[model samples]
Target: MILADLQSRLRIALTNTLVEEWTLFTPTTGTSRPSARTIAFHLGWYLRQTVERTWSVDSEYDRSGMVLEQAVQFDGDTRHVPDLIVHQRGLLGPEHNLLLAHVSVDEASGPDDVPELSSAQALQRRFGYRYAMLLDLRLHVEGRRASVTPYWQWATLEKGAESPEPVAVYTPRVLAEITERARRAGD
Candidate 1:
């Protein structure tokens, strides 16, 4: 699929996920925010609904049989498990590797924790994915309810692109309205 079409579909799915699964973002029991992996799973579910049945949406799928190269300065394990992926299972080529995404909630310790533009481009080169996305969602926890802040940004790197582009899926006003609805639901 073309980059614009893919991005539009992804935006719809992501917006649906946030609107429908707001409870996941806001925990009734504790103050702790949901993990990125947890949110990705839900996002993947929504993405699956938006795509054709042939497309498989998975979260934290590490067994793609592709190994990522580690940086010389970093001694830690280089196993790069994408938070979300859209592709056909068992097809290892770029044709089948539609999208690769890394998601992070709240504050990331460093670039390693959340892949930035350069790292996203490297992943696209190594994995041969048509697109790479970095989704940064910040949680604003108030008592038992938490809402995703408008500060969230979606950065995307297209195939052979020099740098990643920031795309606004929805207006901050829309996000605020949804957040208010979520907050009301919690009460």
Candidate 2:
């Protein structure tokens, strides 16, 4: 369809995934859940930060740890949803342009990663995001309490930005705890 339609669809799907993960962790809790808006905002922040930056690099080593979340598609499996995102950048001034690109915003859009393309080198050239972050949400059980994780990060894909490799991965428990306060507000 259109970019607006696709963006909305992605947001909805991401929110659903977050909530689904949340439920899996806190299955017994009757507490209010985080809002879709909060998840989307947090995700957006990461997209603008991590993915946009490193994915554009020309590095040959693993860049997973440095980023909040990352995954590469292979074989016939192709469905992946990253938490944070940077839509698109402007050709002129930063203030004049937005992070969300017109095409990617579409629901029928294609994947950013091309198998033949190098993860770093093709990042910006193919995707064209100014920033990127992938939220890693998972369930953690400690004693009798359950928690959600949050993997928020900020990075840029601009040619001028730094190109550090990825590092350790964050779990859903970490992410939920970090944003727990604001997440409560979302309920």
TM-score, every prediction:
0.80, 0.33
lDDT of 2 by residue, 67-174 (tens): 312443221244233323333222333321223211111111234421211332224333444444332333344554555443222244454223253222344564
Among these predictions, the greatest lDDT belongs to 1
Q: Write down the TM-score for model 1.
A: 0.80
Model 2: residues with Cα > 4 Å off, grouped in runs: 1-25, 29-123, 142-144, 152-154, 159-187
Indicate which candidate wins on TM-score.
1
lDDT at 116, model 2: 19
Model 1, residue 94: what's the lDDT?
77
User: lDDT of each prediction vs. the true structure?
Assistant: 0.68, 0.35
**lDDT tens digits by residue: candidate 1, 3-58:** 77887787777777777778777767555677888888888888898888888898
Q: Please list all clashing residue pairs in model 1, or write none if there are none.
A: none
